[model samples]
Target chain A: MNRVCIVGVGSPSGDDQAGWLTVDALLDLGIRSGDGVVIEKLDRPGSALIPLLRSTAWLIVVDAMQGEGEAGQIQRFDETGWPHYGHGLSSHGLGVIDALMLAGELGSLPPRLDLYGIEIAGTTPGSSPGRAIRAAATRLAAMISDQLASGFSIPPGTQPGYG
Target chain B: MTESLRSVSIHVPVLARVEGEGALDLRIDNGEIAELRLRIFEPPRFFEKFLEGHLYSEIPDMVARICGICPVAYQATAAQALEKLFGVELDPWARDMRRVFYCGEWIQSHSLHIHLLAAPDFFGCSNAIELARIAPEEVRRGLRIQALGNELMDLFGARSVHPVGVRIGGFHAAPALSRIKEMRDKLRAALPEAEALVRWAARIPVPQDDQGFVSVAMRHPDGYAIEQGRIGVSDGARIEAEAFDDHFAEHHEPFSTALFCTYHKRPYLVGPLARLNLNHAQLPEAIKALLAETGLELPSRNLFHSLAARAVEILLALHEALRLLENYRPPDSPWVPVTPRAGVAIGCTEAPRGLLWHRYEMDDDGRVVSARIVPPTSQNQGRIEEDLRLSLLNFGLDQPDDALRLHCEKVIRNYDPCISCATHFLRMRVART
Candidate 1:
């Protein structure tokens, strides 16, 4: 069985919790570890993500992002499109893009890598995820669950874009 | 020089590889520096003010939030201060484990700075990604060592970033023997890699720009101080943490939110280089031998040697952690009970960056009435400015704006300045006349 790993990268700040909330939504949907799927949530893992990326064969990363789109917009990106969206979004020193770049340089990127980004409304400290973000997280969680159920392979010609 | 080129201004909107936001402004007049300001514009995060009214038990976690890169320093310093005021003496087990935990921080923080932040500057690369392209094995080894350090931190603190395992008396819980054994095996394996890193760092061909500055760090008679020691200055003065204010002062700079600190009104150096300068003799004999092999002298005068210093310290931290964890026994309790009394508390520790000092005034109920935490980066601000002035002069003022700006950044980043922790990156505006 091909091992599949789902990592939700986020902090607890407001809409930044989208990633973790999505993970929570996954658990709520009965998509869990065992059965060749590994679930993990990371709080601003930064470069620490490299080791995890190296350990898995198939990887799906869910994160909150700010982009030129409406709040709670869910977008899917593979390796090519992920890099373009990864820079300058993190207030932390090394963001997800930087980590992916490092992993790429080190040849640690998984054989199959997918990124799911939920457009965040805000990242106010000590605040909970807003209504739109929570809804988006749920939607993304179901989408990821369907992907996991289908043996972790994207269908051919499935264009990358907002869901 | 052309009349128009005599006065030039260079501005860097944001600095890369630094921990937080800041900028630099330089004005050169008639082939001389007329003005240079290491402007730190990161919003003043009133962490000290935020500590007011918080319970003493909350300090370790709260302070840890100050810097994601070196949260252990903040947590450990704050814990030490509160423990001192409360008359809490940690169990020997807790004490040893605390040192081990701190070792984790040193290893990880130093590794990150060396591999990701500082190394690229020396290699003519823009970032760690570029550095990896040139030195994939070194970068991989660095990441491995960094991961091992984070694992060590996680052993005690429960997580590497803003760890919550620390408390006033000791850690909230002791790590299991199984985990200790696992981490010990990893640390032992990384020893050779760390040594190789020292050799690689020594061969980096750092520029020969040595300047005069006072060196200050904590000195432990038992070992190279990490968690405890008396303040040691290069001028041969020893002081306790309580006397820190009397000997050193923090003054406001109009250009930066971070305070510029001075030892007796003169800028001084801190962090790895300072630690190695004052306490190299305390290092393990093997580490000393490795330093000798690298042909790096103790009390090194060149600031660029800081990279070497950090590498040496990483080796030291790895060895220290291994030695301590070799005979690990889970204590009945990782921490002892504490009673709070109203009084002023003070503690100091060697943070990965430099010496971190913490002070708190506690009420009878064990709540903080006031708090003052001094991080290493802010303390280095004056020295950074001083270094910038001397280094640029030595490099010659006839250089172009971009060259001058990059040189200024190189100098600042050499300190491993955590602008966020210091209330900091760096924008560079160089004005020349």
Candidate 2:
């Protein structure tokens, strides 16, 4: 069984693909499924995230989010900070935050759960992510690699391997 | 005296615990409802226009995008319709698998609604989280059942969310025997849990606001309808998919983008309760015995009985899937060859919500010329509005605004309205004297 499960949550629409693209970069960096780390890309898994969360000791979720920062800014949050993130009611049933909240209620949350948000300007349907977003995804992948290498205790603001 | 003569209005900016975005506006004058609108403000997604000029082969995948919750419904309806137009007979293996695939959708969608969306209202809880605190075991069980449904879908569709395995004649490919056995084992194991859910749901103390309305669903000759059937109305009328427009009509209201459908110019019921009401006789004997044990009578008038209806269907779906998969074998080919002809194509299936009707005009090259797809939510819109008017009045319009608002939201959510599909939901405003 994999000790670390990295789930990329998003769709094919423009910047929403940030999480999926980040997973791609991680694979390009040689993080295979058999290396104690399982990588997956889910297009709005909703409540389905609960099962995946319980399958690993450490769970890392990467997704595109709107925040008070420039596009492509990367931020990290743990379970404690999730409520402050303002989880609105999703039009499409149990969104990421709602699923996390549900999982927390069910006692299905992993022992270590990390959420990485790639700040995005917008998600246009059928469009690819812009350059800044791609660059940020690469940087985030490298940061995640470093975290895994350092026994999962790497602090935020550690410079990414990429510029 | 002057207060009694004054008019009042109440509005909710957005609805909660239901799928999609929508709001409700209620105006009261002289102690009577002056105006009420279930406004569905989600921007119109012209899925029908998008289907134009698309090849018949692409219809299943494209239509599946309409609802993440019930993609199989869209895919099945589209595939069945095109197959009818092309005169392609499906392999028996494909036929059984299609039913199994649809059962997965019913199980998942009903479980999610019963546990997460609709249950809280009966429990006096604000959301599933609150309900979980009081009923953790039940919530866990619900989640487990839900996960099983998703797995069943993945068995054939490749993935549950907007599954891509469906094709024109049948599935894109067949599942191996090993995967089928794995799913069969899971289905057998879930049967008891599903039955328990039905009993638990039947025990919930729903309001006694019984009212008369017509129930509509698909009726099949062989068994409980899921994938294919004629449109069955509680009034003893049955019609084919092509005749749907002749009896049922969709008209738009100014305040909402979703069309309100009526049977013979009157709002009628659909979805789980309606299905159970129309086809309870067709259910397996064990399921019928279970329903009898709950003491919930068929042709139930109470709208809240929808929760129990959904739970019952979950058990039924599990039983059906198991029966179909018990002797499963990999077919030589999952799909048959298709020859397209220029003509109109029509199909209807029992979505988890209700009857979903699709009509397409096909060209000689098997490309779509025009498409009109009617989802269950839109069909339930008029019925929802009508129910709101009666339920609010019965619940006592003189109740406080918050109490009234919550009541309206509960009533709307009871329908399990996929507002996103209907171009729908409830941000409610009430004006009263």
In candidate 1, stretches whose alpha carbon ends up further than 4 angstroms from where it belongs are: A83-88, A153-163, B1-5, B16-18, B420-433
Report lDDT per candidate. 0.85, 0.85
lDDT of 2: 0.85
Lowest summed lDDT across 10 adjacent residues in model 2 chain B is found at B420-429
**What does the lDDT read for residue B20 in candidate 2?**
60
Q: Candidate 2 docking: what grade?
A: acceptable
Judged by whole-model lDDT over C-alpha atoms, candidate 1 comes out at 0.85
Off by over 4 Å in 2: A83-90, A152-163, B1-7, B16-19, B420-433
The residue-by-residue lDDT of candidate 2 on B1-433, one tens digit each, is 5544456687776655345667888887777888788888777899999999999999999999998899999999999999999999999999999999999999988888888888987888877777888888888889889999998888889999889999999899999998888888889889999999999999999988878899999998998989988999999999988999889999988788788889999998889999999999988999999999999999899898999999999999999999998888899889999999999999999999998999999999999999999999999998898999989888976777777777887898899888732111234454443
For candidate 1, give the docking quality class from DockQ: acceptable
Position B265, candidate 1: lDDT: 97
